[model samples]
Target: MEEETDTEEEKLLKRQRRERKELQAKIQGMKNAVPKNDKKRRKQLTEDVARLEAEMDERHQQEVEHLRLEISKQVEVESLANGIGKLECEDGEKTAQHSRPTKAQKRRDKKAALEKEREERIAEAEIENLSGVRHLENQKLGHVLAGRGLQIKQIPSDGHCMYRAVEDQLKERGSMLTLAQLRSQTAQYMQGHVDDFLPFLITPSTGDVYTPEEFEKYCDDIVNTPAWGGQLELRALSHILQTPIEVVQADSSPIVVGEEYSSKPVILVYMRHAYGLGEHYNSVEELKDRTTEIG
Candidate 1:
């Protein structure tokens, strides 16, 4: 029975590890699809990873607790039987002393202690890896831009960074669209094509699909408020402008939205941690000279 229980515990741990590995692979795929410099996306991913780990740990704890209880009951039964035999042999004059822990119990306790230590080490290593990735991405962004003879043109960290970056790109192409105009047009486009955009609109508080009314309010926020723009807004802008929008980030190749609209693409740099605030976008301009410092 002890060996059988040990085998079950080992199987449970292996299954847990496999599930975690699959989840991490899925998260990495998501990271690849989007810009790595998206602070919000990275934060969301981190939270998801942490949540998953916590859940797995909780489940393992519960299972171990259950197993411990079963073992304790078995030990009590065996000790009771042994006590009866000793009492009978001594003709009821003496009682049985408490039994020492079995070899199997000692081995199980040691294994559990070692497993906990391993988990703690793994968690610490994961935290360090996340920090290292953030630092490496910052350095890689500079190298990526320099290789292309382009440099980041800083945009204000206001909620309108995406629009402002687009505005800067439009100006270079002799288009005089202000950020306000871009915001308004993007909102209007999304409103007119509700079928296309409404499905993607989610109510953050409920984590549910947005109702038509909620979707309208979202569009209103886009036009009137300083709500940050993201992939959805980028898609609307790309369609409205009839141009492809290319987003360059540190850890991945450029992500181009609306490629079918035009061969020429307006480019923007995505910074994960450039400003201390959060995710941000900036315009890219040609390097004045090789001597120009990469910001």
Candidate 2:
């Protein structure tokens, strides 16, 4: 539907462009056709040129108005769709409360947990200026982590930060993993547990929820390309590694993937202002020992 609408809009725009060009050419021709000494003819030519210009301007204004209306209509549709989706989710949650031990119930629970984290567990919207960390603020957060016997291990600010951070965390625990392998594993995990991840899989670019097919392509991208990881990927990694992944931010409470008493040690990551200008990731860990001093 969106593609069809875009195609129609493009056709209209192309028609308008052609019309404007013709009007310009016609006006220029009329002006050039009149000789300087032919005053009466020149006056008539000028009027004709002005009339053509007026038509062009009117067409331009109409096109602009049409585009504005189209944009307004799209916004309304998107708003309505979002509202309906929210209501459906609410209704599903109400039903899930009384649901049996079926697959639907499990899906409902996963959806609820994921939505809660996406909406309320993290305060990521206000931390958009992630060009780099503020020294004073980073120091404060670091001190807090240090008090908890942890410190940040800086990772490269490249687009692969998230993958690198996860790899580093795994390596520290005696596993030599590469970013590519981790990405592949994460993609595989998400594919195998589609029901668990599907409800939470939204396209960041479109702000639309993903269909299973769309998600499959997303999984392929994760496996075949070096895409930056986000919350969904983090959760997928936790399942893939069978370890609880904990993400601690400066402002929000830590997000945990599994129970605190789980036998597998928790993997910790510290998110700084690491991803506004460009997305990146960093690992937070127990303080390193250097001559018995902590890093």
Candidate 3:
């Protein structure tokens, strides 16, 4: 009967601990979900969370008492069984000696102790640490962008069942912006500079050179990203950011370099004005430094 009571108490304590652990995990999840800005809502959630934790601790304390009772019951059972002759050896020898714990068992116990201490230390540190609180910076940044009306509802930019994002700024604020305006805005947005990236202007027409920055941005954003092939030796003539002046054919055609020609590499800048300026630039650096204002 005592053994049975001990078993029941042990089981009950185990169940109580399990329930407390689950409550702890749940409270943690709710804390994560509640935003810092929503003070009233956060306060309510926090109070409820606190209540849950208090209840869990209360239950756990009760479980500890139950566990103590269980141990006592087990001890009593062992004493009663020892009182019975059936438990004793018929041919009694000297009591077997208890060997010291193995090195592995000792190490495992030490590891467990250390882990418990570390967890306690972390919890204490969390109490002292204000910066451990996550303000959800990424989501805040997203909201900032959204507030600026940068969010354009994705719509199909093509016949395929796919949606392409047109910047809200582009559709509304920049609706009347020219190529120059577009280029300047992108440069300002990205690098706080007044440069432009015009990727479709120069080709076998202007006979101008390319800049390294222009080449990289074109590859990163357009050629590698959009995967537009066949247009080899793409050059930028513009000094601005996004709206780079690129070298396209006379009719703004995509030029296939090797298949189009071999030895005589005829490079063209898109604008006739750019071709007019070609005689002005002696080298690549000169072209990059040259900012033209067409009369």
Whose lDDT is greatest here? 1
lDDT (Cα, tens digit) per residue for candidate 3, span 61-147:
434445556768987997788677443543232353444558998999899799768666754654344222222322332243343
Best by TM-score: 1
Off by over 4 Å in 1: 1-135, 291-295
| 1 against 3, candidate with superior TM-score | 1
Whole-model Cα lDDT of every candidate shown, in order: 0.74, 0.65, 0.37
lDDT, model 3: 0.37
Against the hidden reference, what TM-scores do the models get? 0.55, 0.49, 0.25
Q: For model 1, how does the per-residue alpha-carbon lDDT over 88-163 read when each residue is reduced to its tens digit?
A: 8676444545545689989998998998687667556655665676677767876788878887888997668889
**C-alpha displacement of 89 in model 1, angstroms?**
86
Candidate 2 local lDDT, 1-295, one digit each (tens)? 1344234344554566576687688677777778889999997675445334433443344454456568679879989998998998789889787755679889998997887576442335323323235554476667667767777788875446778887888887898779988988899988888887776554534646788789899899888865556667777777777777776667667766654446555555555334322223577777674333334
Total clashing pairs for each candidate: 0, 0, 26
The lDDT of model 1 is 0.74
